[model samples]
Target: MTPSDASPWNSPGTVRQLGKMLFDHNPTLKINPSVIPSIVGWGLRFLANSTYERHKANMISNIRIARLSLEALRSIRQTAHLNYDQTTRGTMRVFPRGGRMTEFVQMCREMKQWGVQFEVLDQNQILEKEPCLGAVIDRYVGAVFFPDDESGDAHKFTNEIARLATELGVQLLLNTNILKIVNGSSSRISHLSTSRGDVSADVYVLSLGSYSPILARPLGISLPIIPVKGYSVTVALNGWKGGPTRPVMDDGYHAMMVPMGDRLRMGGRAEFAGYDTRVDEEEGWRVLDDIMKILPVLRSHIDANAVLNWSGLRAMTPGGPPLVGPTSYANLLLNTGHGPLGWTMACGSAKLISDLITHRQV
Candidate 1:
């Protein structure tokens, strides 16, 4: 069934309905709902600790803020296929999930207009309150933490939209690598040289994934985007012991595990290996070590010999946020440099870019 038929994700109410359906039925989407809190906690705690001695309190408070925002969302607002754990991250607790494959982003202006808080629930509290999770009262659950949000299938989402782009008479070439760009005296991009023959469009979008820099240099602009390599090991789980009921992550080790349909996807690490897709089983093992930390009871279930390792280069910009505005070029627009959050912000970024170029609104 089509996405619209599957769920009316456009509205917040439908998001809850869709999420509940997925969380209950689609095991793939029912993953790592607990990371937002952990990442929010540690990231802020660092800032809080350095700025003052009470950063820990500030971090927790910030999580509470995120919690309020998350709580505002009806249960099942969005489902994820990812999660994070901080068992190896010292006393810090904010853990986030799956690729956080954000199903979509509702703009802050829209949220305000809709009378919804711009912020979601506290990230930490998300972990303690996950429907898929359980913990003793007053005893914090060390689970994936984050504001209640959702993620979708990125490959399908990208391919589907890219197909729509093609339907609208937009020419897209896959497996054709872009090599260099021709710029003019004004430093505007005149043409793009690729493995395929050259034909120019009135405007160009640099949604080139990790290869964003290959386009930015021609315009005399330097995007601080870098290729941060992350690896994934997809493995089938036999039962609760071999499989995880909830998503988990260990931010300290930069590793995370996701419970996908029939497979348990484990990944996390920024090995800047420049255009390499090689999967290191040893590195995967290192990541797995962090998983064992949180669920030590499942150590017996560790099939050290079983893993389907794969890698993807995430385009990371210097600033944690992405680059999604027009460039110095008169017509060229940018929608890349998203890094891991690409899935989180894909639709929002696309709509934003489309508005700017298609309608001249930022």
Candidate 2:
């Protein structure tokens, strides 16, 4: 995990971008009419809670948490011996504009103080590291390489972990839709009304990503989380020798491209639309177009029509840090609102929650 926040929702340029997204007809960031009221309410609360001092404190805490997450994932990878198409080739953050490179240099100095390891690379060094980017080298001013950062398949990791958990006596319930959380006479959650049946638990942990707020609202728990939609397009590399060997984050377009086995997955854009999970083909094309600009060589090797488009909602909090640990209900705990860093922070978040539940040192 990187020490700096690169999310479009929480970056330094968020305020200016938010203004455009709210007012202008920005293609990348859309605000549906129905979500405006909710957005306004959340915006007011966000402003009230997000003071400069508070944000600084949260950033420091989150940096520590992110470090721990990276360590935890490494430990799991080594100890479990589970292969999820993991790679340690690191990630490169390329800056197209000189101004963005300056901002990143400032961030690098700040992160260095926190013990985050990174190397600043010039155009020559960046091209040397990944020669596939040579075609678009002129488009970049500079780059930052986080050698400790990693890339992997989240779906593979989850399946492997689930299999291991089942061997450890944890029951698996598939295709069970949680209708609602039902509470008994006491203050805690009694059982969950589900598609299969009502299931009771001694302690309940809410980890339903973007949909957590929807379920928590019935319990008077106003989680300050909004579902921010994002898109991804995966294209088969077709044995393309010019494809990037590692992950690359394009600072200019707020997009990222990662090599996943035989496929190259690129994701970007943040939409403020409410709960709509529909995959827009136009949006997919736009994301593909943006990523192609960063790696123009992909045009000849891969067929544009063979790409897979996906869309998902990320649970974002007003403040960057996720809502973890206990809630008002003693038996209920929260482990959501991770935004774009959900996969990066998942193992550490799970560890923290487990320690909390076990009453161990966290």
Candidate 3:
């Protein structure tokens, strides 16, 4: 969300059998004892229902939503007059191993069919886009550049939106904790039982990130969402001119380094620790190490002791796309379960939910 919050808007492993195929890539993934049975049960259901056709359909839906959301973000930035270290140089995904480029090429071709604009760049082209990466250019075979993609301080954008909404006569409720959702007699949300008091709304939108399922369960809605924890570390450039100018996704380590204004934010690692938002300093350092492995020039410029470590939970669903739109309860709509792409797809998802609520054709 911001440098302060662990949410990436600004911005998983199995047993031995599942590990190599799925989990091994994420060494940080760990399941809480309470969620083990649930995880296993959901895993079985996922495997059983998963099909190549189904996966393709989901991917297509997610990609469309993401592309639309990018445009929405641009509009919001203009509306809010936001310029919090916003980078429009586009984003890049570097494939350290040459073999990975082949798979990416195939994916790019398929994406191109959907009108997604991307350029497949060799090592030299990648360096040209971000000269700070020259130190590790040899380590990369090629990269896929998404020209439409952008990066910025999600926290600042969120706050600006909130401020704008308030100016539009929207009431701002702060420090009020929602204890539960009170159901009405006729398949709808009657009101919310909050820590402050009981508040009623004609319609309610359940956009409570990872905690959405907790309240929905009492209402007989079986939300297949899990809280996946992720880690991030932000380091000041400290006059280091060699840091990346834009966002870079490292394929080898499954991480991202985003230049947020003068600060460089590097975050990655999916740990299924379930609601534990504890920051592991060592893990943060490990992320730095992973980044340094690719950009060795930053080694001398960064001070390890000054890095800020943060952790946040993501609401992930079995299917990649978020569970948006109306639920069984007519007045209660869903806008959660976005996982790691919450910030990227926020505006599009919000627009979709609003259109649905207003009975507008989407």
Candidate 4:
């Protein structure tokens, strides 16, 4: 069924988590919030096969993120970008529509408008750029190549930032959970009631990811956010010559494969399965099958038996783009609702939020 015909529980865009995020709103929360992702989606590997694929998947916001990520990475002193070490120089998006190969003409136009460079590649060009794609070149009509895009390990970057923050005298409360917020009618939060105890700060910025809405609703604040669960699978390339040289989004299969250092991360598929983060083996196989269809050469190049599965909830905002600004509360700021663009826009979002908090122009 198309997204319009699907139930809120199954529809990828429906906002069903508030009933559960805010306990007072509805104690009998029926959203169920089970977030089971398919077992082995190689991350963005299923972009081609996703039933929920949209023609206007918010390409404008994508350009903003792409530009901002570069700036932010440099500000943080990450050598990954400076050393030209980004595993994937760009992304190859391939898809088919109505028994014919589809070209991303409009998408290219939008990207160009936003100063993001891209190239349209036919079967021969695609196979030349990525030799491993020779196995499934005939399955797709054509592909779009985004030359400036990139892929890297976000976890490592986060840890490095955390280290820098700590060294710069930034206090980080580890293993701390906020039970509730203590705020008066005014725009400032006095302190936060937490599992670790009461912690007070002059200003508060909530970046609770998907749970931000739940925390803000009680304070009479509303955020347009929904938790979209996405899945990933990491496999060992082990010097496999057929492995993807860059990120490849096979839109026809609804999945993508990203080269992460020595590993290959393939994944794609957004499930509106609420807060559940379980893994669905059957669905995982479906994702895997789609990946195989896009790059059959991977079967001989990599070991499929050793696969690592992962699932995470993305705080998706309807129509793409994220909410990054202040709330009605003067002292209580907001920096959440990033959705799938979290990594793509992380540093840029952080830079914007930081500039806002510091009363500086962006």
lDDT of each prediction vs. the true structure?
0.48, 0.80, 0.75, 0.65
Tens digits of per-residue lDDT, candidate 1, 241-328, equal 4443344444333445565545566666555456666776776666566555544544565465776767788775533346788887
Best candidate according to TM-score: 2
Please give the lDDT score at residue 224 for candidate 1.
Answer: 68
- Per-residue CA lDDT of model 3 for 1-362, tens digit only, reads 21101112210111233344244643655555677776776556555434555555665667777777777777776666765678887788898865456755665676666656688898889888988888778888899887767788777778878888888999978899999998876587889999999999877899999999999999999898888888888888876767788789887777789988778998888777778888988778888888888788777877778888998988987766788888888788999998878887788888888888788421
**lDDT for residue 112 in candidate 4, whole number 0-100:** 76
Alpha carbon lDDT of residue 24, candidate 4? 34
Candidate scoring better on TM-score of 2 and 4: 2
Query: Tens digit of lDDT per residue, candidate 2, span 1-362?
Result: 45445322444445545565556443666767788888887777556445546555666667766777888877877767776767788899899865468866776677767766788999999998889888889988899998878887777889999988898899988899999988664467889999999998888899999999989998889998999999999998877767888889888777888888888888888888888999998999888888888888788888888989999998988776788888877788999998878887787888889889889321
Pairs in steric clash, model 2: none
Q: TM-score of every model?
A: 0.58, 0.93, 0.90, 0.79
The worst-scoring run of ten residues by lDDT in candidate 3 lies at: 3-12
Rank by lDDT, descending? Answer: 2, 3, 4, 1
Where in model 1 is the C-alpha error above 4 Å?
Answer: 1-147, 163-171, 184-187, 238-246, 251-254, 296-306
Give candidate 2's whole-model lDDT.
0.80
